[model samples]
Target chain A: MSEDLRERFPEAEWIDSHDQDVVRIAPDQLLEFGNVVHEAGFEVLADVTAVDWYRTRTPRFDVVVNLLSMQHRRRLRILVGVPDGDPVVPSLVPIWPGANFGEREVYDMFGITFDGHPDLTRILMPDDWEGYPLRKDFEVGAVPVQFKASHQVN
Target chain B: MTDKTIDDPEIEEVDLWVSGTEEAEWDVYSTDEGAQKMRLEETGARLTEQLGSVVTDDYDLDDIITEDERMIINMGPQHPSTHGVLRLQLELEGEMIRRSKCVIGYLHTGMEKTAETLTFLQGPTNVTRMDYLAPLHNELCFSLAVERLLDIEVPPRAEVIRILMTELNRIASHLVAMATNGMDIGALSIMTYGFREREQILAFFEKTTGLRLNHNYIRPGGVAADLPPGWRADVSDICDTITGRLTDYEDMLKENPIWVGRTRGVGVITAEECRAYGITGPTLRSAGVPWDLRKAFPYSGIENYEFEVPVGEHGDVYDRYRVRIEEIIQSVGIVRQAADAMPKGDFRIDDRKVTPPPRHRIDESMEALIHHFKIFTEGFRVPAGETYVAIESPRGELGCYLVADGTGKPWRMHTRAPSFYNLQALPIMMADSVVADTIATIASLDPVMGDVDR
Candidate 1:
C-alpha cells in the first residue's frame, strides 16, 4: 500500500515509523491527499491531532491525521508540517464529517486552525480559554500545596 | 399579555409528524433579553444548524410549523438519564426534536496534557481513568502503543491473560450499558439485576488488579501480574452464572412489548451515517456493518479465539440492545477459550530494562535492587517515533496515539476516545424523534462521561 501511495504521489515523502506508513506532506496537499485516500476506501478518519515541536524542529508542528480503510483493514497516518507562524491546515471535514470534533480538539489544544471547518470552536476546553494547553511552550501550571501544620523539612 | 383560555378557537391542534426540513430558524423576539441569553440563543441556533444538516435534507417546514412554536431547550449536564455530564440542546417543534446539539467538556481534566509529564511506565495509570467503566481497555491501548514504539513483545502467557481480562471487561461494560438503558426507560429492576451480575466480574478484577475502577494493571512490558490462583474456576463460574442470568434478562426485556415499542423504531441511524460519523463497536454493528476491530484488525492474539460478531438489521435502539446482549455471550465464549489455552510461562517480557526483577529477587540480589529502583524512578527510554494503536473497547474503537522522543517521558500522548466519537452520532439519532426518546437514544450509545470529556 505504501508503494502504491508512493508511486501515485512522488512529491510526498513517506516514512515507515515502527512498520507503520507515515506520509509527510505540505499543508497545501492535505485536502487532495485526503480525497485520494477517501476515494480509495479509507472511509474512517480515526483521529486528527497535532504535535508542537517547540525549538526542536524547523516546521514547528506536525498535524497528524489517522485514516482507516474498513474495506481493506488498513491504517495510514498522514502528517502535515505547519510553520510556527501559520499553523493552519485545510480541514478534512469536507471529506469526512467525523473529522469535525477531532479537528476542533486539535484547534483547542494546539492552537492550529482548520481553514474550512464548519464550526471551528473549542470542543473540550472552555470558550474563554487563554492559550493552547497541548503546545510544548504551554506551562504545566502546577500549583503548590500548603499543608495545615507541617512545614517543609530541609 | 392577553388572557388566553384553554378554549381559545385560534389555537391549532398540533399533530406529531416527521418534518423533512433541513434548516430551521431561531429568531428570538424579546425586547428585554440579556446578553447572556442572546449569546446562548445564538450558540443554540448555530449548533442546531450544524447538527441538523447532517441527517436531514433541505426542505421547507414553515408552512406546517411556525417559528414561534419552535423552542430551544436544554436537557442535561444534570439529568439522570444522560449517563454522565452530557448536555443536549434540542430544537423542538411541539415535542418532536427538529434539531439537536451535544454540549460537553464539563469533566475535562486535561489528561492528554498531563500524559506528557508521565513516563511510559506511568502512562497506563493516567489513561486508565479516561473510560472508567472499561479502564483495562484504556490501559491496554496505551500499553500496545508504547510496546509498538519499543518494538518488544510480551510472553504468550501475558497475551492470553490480556485477552481473558479484556473479554471479561467487555461483558461487565455491556452489563452496565444494559442496566442504565433499562433504568432510563423506567425499568428500574434491571438496573439492580445488571449491577448485581456485574459485581461478580468486578470481584474477579479486584482479586487480580487490586482496584475495581482504575486498574493500571496492564502496563507496557506486560500486565502488572499474572493471573491469580484459581482464576480458571472463577472465570468459569462467572461465565456460567452470567450465562444463566442472561436468559433472565432476555425473558424480561427481549420480548417485552413495552421494551420493543420504546426502542424498536427510536434513534434510527443507517450504516452510511455511521461510517460518515466514524461510529464503531456495537453501535456500528447494530447498523449491520460487522466492523469489529478485534476481528478486522486483530490485536493481542484475539484472532486466535473463535467467536461470532453479532450484527443487527435496523440501526435503532433495540438493535443496539440486542447486539450488546449477544456480544456478552460471545465474549464469554472468547474468555472460556482464552482460559483453556492459557500458556504457562513468564507473565511479563524478559527484558530487564522494561520489566523489573521479581520482588524476591530484588530483596536477595544487589543488582536486582538497583535495577528495580532505577526502573521505577527514571523508567526506560523508548526510541523516538510515533505510533497509534487501537483496540475494541465496549464503547467503540479505543485508540492511543503515542509520540516518544528518546526520553523517559512521552513527547505527546493522545487518545482517540470511542465515547467522544460516538457522541457525535447523538444528534443524528435524536433528530425527528420525540423528547422522551432522547433518553433511550443516549442510553443506547452507552457513553461514559470520563471518556467523552477526556
Candidate 2:
C-alpha cells in the first residue's frame, strides 16, 4: 500500500518513521492523496492533530492524519506541511465526515484552517480566545490566577 | 385608580359559520371617536383583503409552520443530565428534536499543550487526568507511545501486569458507564448494583497501586511499582465477586421489561453511521463491528489473552448496554488468566537511566547515589522520532501521538481521546429523536467531558 501510494503520487515523500508508514505530501496535494488512500481501503480517520515546529522547520505546522483501515487492519499516517504564511489545508470532510470535529480541534488548538469544512468554528476553545494555545510561540501562563477569599463561619 | 369589572358580553343564539365572501368580517359599529376609528377600520380592511380568508380558509398544515415555529433550546453547560458541562443547542418542533449541535470546551484545560511542557517521565502524570474514568488506559497509551519512540521493550512481567491492570480498569470503567447509564434512563436500582461492584474493583486497584482513579502505575519503561503482596488474591476475590454481581445485573436489567422498553430501540445508530462518526469501543461493537484494538492491534501482550470480543446485532441503546455487560464478563476472564500466568521478574526495566537505583544501594554506594542524582536531576533523553500508539480504551480508541526532539521533554504530545470522537456521534444519534430521549442518548454515548474537552 505504501508502494502504491508512492507510485500513485511520486511528488509526495514517504517516510517509514519508527515502523509506522508516514507519507509527507505537499499541502496542495493533501486532498488528492487523501482520495487515493481513502480508495485504498483506509476508511477510518483515527486521529487528526498538528505539530508546530514554528521557526525550527520551514513549514510552521505538520497536520498529521492517522488513517486506519478496519478491513485491512493497518494504519497509515499522512503528514501535510502547511507553511507559515498560508497555514491552510483542504478539508477531508467531503471524504470522511469524522474529520469534522478533529479538524476543528486542530484549528482550535493550532490556528491551522481546514478550508472546505462546512462549519470550522472554534472547538475546545472560547470563540474570543486570544491566540492558538498549542502553538510553540504562544506564551503560556499569560492568564493570571485569581482566588477569591473564602467565607466560613468559625 | 378604582378597580372595576368590565361588562361581560352575553352569548345569544348565533350561527357557527358566516358566509361573508370567504373573508374575515368585523362589525363597523364602535364607541371610539375620530381618527382611531378610521385607523382601526383601515387596518382591518387591509388585513382581510391580503389574508383573503381567516376562519373558513382551506390551507395546508405545513404552510403555517415557519422557521420561527421550530424552537431552539439550550440544554446545558449546566444541566445535570448532560453528564458534564456540555451545552447542547437543540432545535425542537413541539416535542420532537429537529436538529442538535453539541457545544463543548467548558472543561478544556489545554492538557495537550501542558504535555509539551512536561518531560517524558511526567507525561503520563498529565495525561492520566484527561480521561478520568479510565486513567490507567490514558497513562498506558502515553507510556506505550514513549516506549516506542525510545525504542525499548518492557519486561515480560511488566507487560502481563499492564494487561492485568488495564483489563481491570476496563471493567471498572464499564461499571461506571452502566451505573450512570442506568440512573440516566430511570433504572435507578442498577446504579446501586453497578457502583457496589465498582467500589470492590477500585479497592483492589488501591491495594495494588495506592490510588483509586488516577493510578499512574504504567510508566514508559515499565510500571511505576511492583505489585504488592497478595495482589493476586485480591484480584481473584474481586473477579469472583464481579462474576457473581454481573449475573445479578443481568437478572435486574436483561430480563426486566422496563429496562428493555427504555433502551431496546432508543438512540439507534447504524453500523455505517458509527463508522462515519469514528465511534468505537462498545458502541461500535453494539453496531456489530468486531474491530477491538485489543483483538486487532494486540498491544501490551493483549494477543495472549483468551477472550471473546462481544458484539451486538442492533446498534441501539440496549445493545450498547448488553455489549458493555458482556465485556465486563470477558474482562473478568482475562483478569483471571493474567493472575494464573503472572510471571516473576523485575517489574521495571533494569536500565540505570530509566529506572532509578535501589534505595539500599543508594544508601550504601556513592556510584549509586551519583547515578540516582543524575537521573532525577535530568531525566534521560529519547532519540528523535514520532509515533502514534493506540489501545482499546474503555470508551474507544485511546491513541497517543508523541514526537520527541532528542530532549527530556516531548516536542509535541497529543492524545486522540475516544470521548471526543464518541461525543461527535451524539448529534447523529439524537437526530429526529424525541427531546426527552436526549438524556438516554447522552448517557449511552458515555463521554467523559475531561476526555472531550482535553
Candidate 3:
C-alpha cells in the first residue's frame, strides 16, 4: 500500500519509522492527497495531532494524521510539515468530517491553522488563551510551593 | 418574558424577539436597508445569503422561523445528565432540537504536555488517567506504543495477563455505561444494580493493581507485577456473579415498555455515519459494523482467545445498550478463557535495559543493584522513532502516538482518546430529537469527560 501511494504521489517522502509507513507531504498538497486516499478507501480519519520541534528541525511543526481503512483493515500515517513563519495546512474536514475536532485540537495545541475548516475556533483551550501550550518553546509553568512557616535552609 | 421588565428600576422595553442576542450578534436582525432590499429583490437571496447562494428545495426549519422564536440554550457544564463537564449548545424550536453542538474542554489539564517530560516507564502513569473508567486500556495502549518503538516483546505470561486485565476492565466500563444510561432514562433501579455488579469487578482490580481508578500498573516492559494469589477463584466468582445478575438486569429493563419506548428509536446513527465520524467500539458495533480491533487487528495475543463480537442492527440508543450488554457477556467469556490458558513464566520482559532487576537479584548482585538504580533514576533510552498503537477500549479505539528523540524522556506523547472522537458524533445523533431525549442520547454515547478533555 505504501509503495502504491509512493508511485501515485512521486513527490511525497515515504519514511519508514519503526516498521510503520509515514508519508510526509508538503502543506499545499494535503487536500489533494487526502482526496486520493479517501478514494483509496481510507474511510476513517482516526487521529490528527502535531509535534513542534523548536530550534532542532527546519519546518518547526509536523501535523500528523492517522487514517484507517476499515474495509481493508489497514492504517496509514500522513505527515505535513508547516514552517514556523506560516503554519497553515488545508483542512481534511471536507474528505472526513471526523477531522473537525482533531484539527481543532491540533490548532489549539500547536497554533497551526487549518484553512478550510468550518469552525476553526479553539476546542480544547479557552477562547482567550494566550499561546499554544503544546509547542516545545512554551514553558511548562511551575508554581513554587510556599512553606507555611518560612524556614531557613542550612 | 414580560415579568423581567417590571423587576428592575432601570426598566427598558423587554424585546423578547432578540432577548439573548447580546453575545452572538449575527443572529440579530440586520438594520442595513441595501442588504434587505437585495434580499427582497431576489426570492432565493435569503437562502443564498445564509447558505452561500446554494439554493435547494430542502431548506432548514431554522431558515423559515424568526430568530426570536428559535431559542438557543446551554444544557450544561454542570447539569447532572451531561455525564461530566460536557456542555451542549442546543438550537431549539419549541421542544424539538434543530441542531446541537458539544462544548467540551472544561477538564483540560495539559497531560500531553506533561507526558513529554516523563520517561517511557512513567508514560503509563500519565495516560492511565485519560480514560479513568478504562485506565488499564489507556496504559496498555501507551505501553504497546513504547514497546513498538523499543523493539521488544513481553513474555507470553505478561501478554495473557494484559488481555485478562483489559477484558475485565471492559466489562467494568460497560457496567458504568449501562448504569448511567439507565439513570438518565429514569430507570433508577438499574443504576444501583449495574454499580453493584461493577463493584465486584473493581474489587478484583483493586486486588491486582493496588489503586481503584488510576492503576498505573501496566508499564512499558510489562505489567507492574504478576497476578495475585487466588486470582482464579476471584475470577470465577466475578464471572459467576455477573452472569447471574445480568439475567436479573434483563428481566428488569430489557422487556420493560418504558425502557423500550425511551431508547428503541432514539439517537440513530447508521454504519456510514459511524465511519465518517470515526466512531468505534460498541457505538460502531451497534451500527452493525463488526470492526473490533481485538478481532480485526489482533494485539497482545488476543487472537488466541475464542470470543464473538456482538453487533446491533438498528444503531439506535437501544442497540447501543444491547451491544454493551452483549459485550459484557463476551468479555466475561474471554476472561474465563484467559484464566484457563494462563501461562507460567516471567511476568515482565527479561531485558535489563528496559526492565529493572528483581528485588531478590538487586539484593544479591552489585551489578543488579546498579542496574535497578539506573533504570529508576535515569530510565532507559529508546531509539529515536515514532509509532502509533491502538487498542479497543470500552468506548472506542484508544490509541497512543509516541515519538522518541534518543532520550529517556519522550519528545512527544499524545493519546488518541476514544471518548474525544465518539463525542464528535453526538450532534448528529441528537439532531431533530426532542429536548428530553438529548440526555438519553449523550448517555448512550458513554463519553468520559477526562478522556474527552485530555
Candidate 4:
C-alpha cells in the first residue's frame, strides 16, 4: 500500500505511518490527494481534526483525516498544511457524510474554513462563538479557571 | 418537528386531524401493528395504523373528545437517555410519537481542538479524558500511533505491560456498561457488583500510574514506570475476584424472567446493519459480526496471546449482554498470559528522546538529570508525518489519528470514537417501540457522552 501510494502520488510525499495511518502529501494536495485516497479503497470518513504550531510550524495548521477500508483492512492518514492568513481547505463532505461535524470542528477550533461544506457552522461551541480556541495563538482566558489556583495537572 | 423527543403512548395530535368543521375529522395514524384504513372521530385523538404497532382494533370509546390538536415537543439537555446532552424534536399524534430528529453537541468539550496546542507527548493526557471509562485504551492508541510515526519498537517488557493494562481496562470499561445498563433496566444491584469489581482494577492503576483516572502510563516508547512491587499478585487478585463475581451476576439476572423479557428479542440489529454502520467491539460481536481489530490487525504483540473473541448468536440486546460477559472472562485470560510472560528488561525504548533515563541515574549523573528535566518540560520530538492507530478498546475500535509536523507537539489529533458510529443505529432500533423502550435502547448502545460529544 505504501509503494502504491508512492507510485500513484509521485508528486506527493509519503512522510511516515503512525500505528496504522500512513501519513502522506501536503497542503497543496489536500483535496485532490484525498479524492485519490477515497478512490483507492478507504470508504469510511473516520475523522478530521487540526493542531496548532504556535509559531514554529511553516503553515501553522496541520489538518488530518483518518480513513478506513473495511474490505482491505488498511487505514490511511492524510495531512495538509493551512497557512496563517487564509487557513482554508476544500471539504470532503461531498464524498463522506460523516465529515459534516468534524469539518465544522476544524473551522471552530483553528479558524480553518471548509470551502464547500454544506453546513460549516459551529457544532461544539456556541453559534456566536468568538475566536478559535484551539489555535496556538488563542488565549485560554475566555472562561475563568476555577478548577484550581495552585496546582496544574501537567 | 426539527428536533423533538418522541414520547407518549396516546395519539391525539398526529393520529386525528380536524379541519374547518368539527365533524369532518380524519384519523391519521393508528397504534395497531396490522390494522389498515381510516377512523374519522370528531376529536383528533387517534390515528389508523399503517406504520405503527399499537393495537387499534379494540379502541376504547370512553375517552371520546370533541376537539383536535397537534404538538411538536423538545426533550432533554437534562435527559441522560438521549445518550449524551442530545436534544430530540418530536412530531406527535396526541400522546403517540410520530417522528423524531436528534440534535447533538451539548457535551462537546473541544478536546480534539485542545490536543493541537500541547506537545505530542502531552496528547495522551487530553485524549484519555474524552472517554473516562476506557482511559487506558485511549492512551494506548495515541501512544502506538506516535511510536509508529517514529518507527521505533518498544522493549518486550513494555509491550507486555501495554497489553496487560489495556485488556484489563477493557474489562473495567465493559463492567461500567453492565453496571449502568443494569441500572437503566431496573436491576439496580447489578450496578453495585460491577462497580465493586471495577474499583479493584482502579486500585491497580493508582498503584502504577500515580493518578487513578487518566493514567498516561502508556507513552510513545513504553510505560511510564516499571512494574511496582506485588503488581502481579495485585492484578491476579482482581482477575480472580472478577471471575467469581461474574458468575454471581449471571446467577442474579441471567435466568430471571424479567431480565429475559426486557432484552431477549428487543433492539435486534442484524449483522448486515452492523457492517453498514461500521460498528465494532462487543456491539458488533453481539450482532454476529467478526471484525475485531485484535483478531484482524493484531497490534502491540496481541498475536502472542491465546484468547478467543466471544461472539453472540442473536443480534439482540440480550446477546450483547452475554457477549460482554464472555469478553470479561477472555480479557482476564489475556491479562494472566501477559503477566506470566512478562520479561525482565527495560520498560521503554532505548531512544533518549522518547524514553526517560533510569531513576537511579538522575541522582548520580548531571546528564541524566538534564534529560529528565527536558523530557518533563519541552517533551520529545517526532519526525514530521501522520499516523492513525486503531486498537480494540472496550466500547469498540478506539483509534487515534495523529499528524506530527516534526515537532514536540502534534499537528492534528483526531479520535475515532466508537459512540459516534454506534449511535447511528439508534433511530432504527427505537422506531417501532414504545416510549418506555427508549431507556433500554439507549442503554444497549452503551455510549459515554464524553466519547460522543468530544
**CAPRI quality level assigned to candidate 1 from its DockQ score:** acceptable
Shift in Å, residue B396, candidate 3: 0.8
Error of 3 at A132 (Å): 0.3
Residue B59 in model 1: lDDT: 24
TM-score of 1: 0.90
Taken over the whole model, the C-alpha lDDT of each candidate is 0.88, 0.83, 0.86, 0.74
Give the poorly placed runs of model 1, Cα more than 4 Å off: A1-4, A142-154, B1-51, B55-64
Ranking by DockQ: 3, 1, 2, 4
Q: What is the C-alpha lDDT profile of model 2 across B1-454, one tens digit per residue?
A: 9454454345355656654433345442232111111122123422221121212222222434567677767898899888889888776668876556688889999898898888888888899899989999999999999888888899999999999999999999999899999998788899998888889888888988889988888998999889888887899999989987777888988989988888887777777767766788989999899889998999988899899999998888899999999999899999999999989998999887688898899999999999888776777798999999999999999999999999999999999999999886776667657877889889888889999998
lDDT of 4 by residue, B85-182 (tens): 76655444566544343456678877876787777778888988988888888999999888888888999999999999998898898898888888
Clashing pairs in 2: B76-B87
Model 1, residue B143: what's the lDDT?
95
Q: Using lDDT as the measure, which candidate wins?
A: 1
Candidate 1 lDDT by residue in tens digits, A51-154: 88999998999999999999988899999999989888999888888888898889988999999887777777777677888998888974346685797677
1 against 2, candidate with superior DockQ: 1
Per-prediction TM-score to the true structure, in the order listed: 0.90, 0.88, 0.90, 0.77
Evaluated at residue A105, the lDDT of candidate 3 is 94
Name the candidate, 2 or 4, with the larger lDDT value. 2
Number of the candidate with higher TM-score, 1 or 4: 1
Using Cα atoms, each model's DockQ against the true complex is 0.44, 0.36, 0.47, 0.19
